[model samples]
Target: MKHLSGKLFISITAYCAISFSSQELAAQSDVLDINEIGNVDISTLLEDTKTFNTIGMGIALSIAECHGKDICEPTVDEGEIGQLIETLDQRIEGVVSRQQNSEEELTPIITAYVDTKEKYADYLERLSEISKPEPELPQEEFVEEDLFTDEDALTEDEYSAFDDFEEDLEDDEDLDEFEDEYDLE
Candidate 1:
């Protein structure tokens, strides 16, 4: 029984370690590959255009949300944005070059794609501007001033009366008993 339990524990530990290491490796490899741009075919480009259109619509919605509630923060970082644009440009160039080499009469389609991509880039810029956090105004430090000088202070009798009231409140046995009873330490 002890041997079986020991083997089970070791297996579980090894499985958990392997899972965690794989997840870490996946996270580290989450960068976009620009070289893959050259390998994109027309079918893949068409599919990617649909995705780009969806992304554009999402950006429009984000703009609307920003205008409506002023809280639409950007989901993509600047570095990632730059990488995406670079990859997109590379893909378009690759497609155009390949078409030119093949003597394919479908250059218009590639031109249209480039135009659409340019518009998407413009939208991305607008989204970036819209999602930027507003600059905060500098806060002023508060310095309280003495409202009344020594010559304009309260009279000795009035001060004594206030002190007496404070002392009386502090010495109230009922208040102390109530605080202790309520556990109001």
Candidate 2:
């Protein structure tokens, strides 16, 4: 009777120990982030999946390392390795679908932006052409008459010299006397 009791005690303790270990391992598994949940755009998610292929490979390699020598070749049906791969594939597919849908939805918006940019460029070109200074009205060719007599052709310095000469002659009485003495009429 004591042996039977001892066996039952051992069984219960083993069960509890197994249950605790499983729970601890489950807790160690990755959980999705809440911030990631809200800010997930399609393109970003697809990019993430594309980058995650490396991680997926790493995980598979780890599984292989752990179960490489296991009995019965460790069929995926009874293992988590194949299931993890399948989950990754499903995640990639979901991301691809979302990316496709987002691209389809944004097509018009992208087109509109490109069209607007082209229009603005054309408008700027036209404005630049319009605002450019035109060839100045053909300048008239200026002609100079005889410099000795033409007042318009005389520079300010030349005019002032001529005025000074005229004043000196007016002040000279000899010129007046000579003119009167030589008069025969």
Candidate 3:
């Protein structure tokens, strides 16, 4: 276990050494040495859009195939870095072109959708404003009270009228029949 850990440590150390020392990575990253940090221009580094991408955060595979504690050297040449940058630039250009093409294709469809929505909104507004007659309230038939209508007045006195009503009741045979049936003598 101890030997394995030591081998792992040595491999990692070698990887770091190669990554920091390689002229290929140095040209792109501007980070030539671990100790000479004061030489790195911070403003320039930040301005370079592709600076940090090439700073060798890649997985360290043992390039030289050293078994244990042997010191390893970087083999990444300038040509390899150039090819890698070219490939990335081509891929980015292709992606940007595809995005622009898709935008052009969709613009007309989006515009048509917006126009249809606006037309529907205008139609809805016109439908809302369409006038209809207000429902006619049932004309409350107000018959005029006849203020000058003639009515017959009693010629006889009030007491005499009551006596006449009682005499008529006694002469009615149906009233007598009803009284007999109800046992009212």
Candidate 4:
């Protein structure tokens, strides 16, 4: 409850500050007091107040963000801002020069890669052409391959051995006798 009341009080205070400032800012948008030498416009005073408020809020947010860490404040000093800007300018120039140098250095390598890629594509195209199935020959032109040629004739001795084996198996009487000896029934 106490914390809630505290937050509510902060909200009210912030609201009042913004509301009162906005009322003071309801004049000519041009805050430059040109041509009038001494007197300043009410809007000019409000704008200056708003600028200070914004800067203060920025500092407050930065401090809050680094609440628990070491080196809580901004690293830059009031005097070092110009030096930091100069250092950044030098670094940007260095980066641009390095990019140009690298492009010059790598040009040949990039050209070689492109040439090799084209050559590889051509090689693959040739492989595809070589791998296509050949067209078949017409049936009239196709000849069956023969297993034997002119020197495969049978010999005279082989024919004589076959005739003798047939003559020896012509005894049906002896064959019937052998059958009768083996029959049990």
The prediction achieving the highest TM-score against the true structure is: 1
Off by over 4 Å in 3: 1-56, 59-72, 104-185
CA lDDT, candidate 4, residue 114: 39
User: Can you give the TM-score per candidate against the true fold?
Assistant: 0.45, 0.24, 0.23, 0.22
lDDT of 4 by residue, 1-185 (tens): 99668645645554455445334433322342232212343344334435334333332333333334443333112333233233324333433344375543433333333343343344334333332234668986766566456566557997788888787666655677788999832
lDDT per model, in order?
0.57, 0.42, 0.44, 0.41
The top-ranked prediction according to lDDT is 1
Worst 10 residues of 2 by lDDT: 69-78
Could you give candidate 1's per-residue lDDT for residues 80-107 as a string of tens digits? 4455466557657766667776765556
**Cα RMSD for predicted model 2:** 35.4
Model 2: which residue pairs collide? none
Evaluated at residue 14, the lDDT of candidate 1 is 40
> What is model 1's C-alpha RMSD?
14.8
Per-residue lDDT tens digits for candidate 3, residues 144-165, read: 4564455544446966998988
TM-score attained by model 2: 0.24
lDDT of 2 at 67: 34
Identify the superior model by TM-score, candidate 2 or candidate 3: 2
What is the alpha-carbon lDDT for the whole of candidate 2?
A: 0.42
Q: After superposition, how far is residue 112 of candidate 4 from its true place, in Å?
A: 61
Predict model 4's lDDT versus the native.
Answer: 0.41
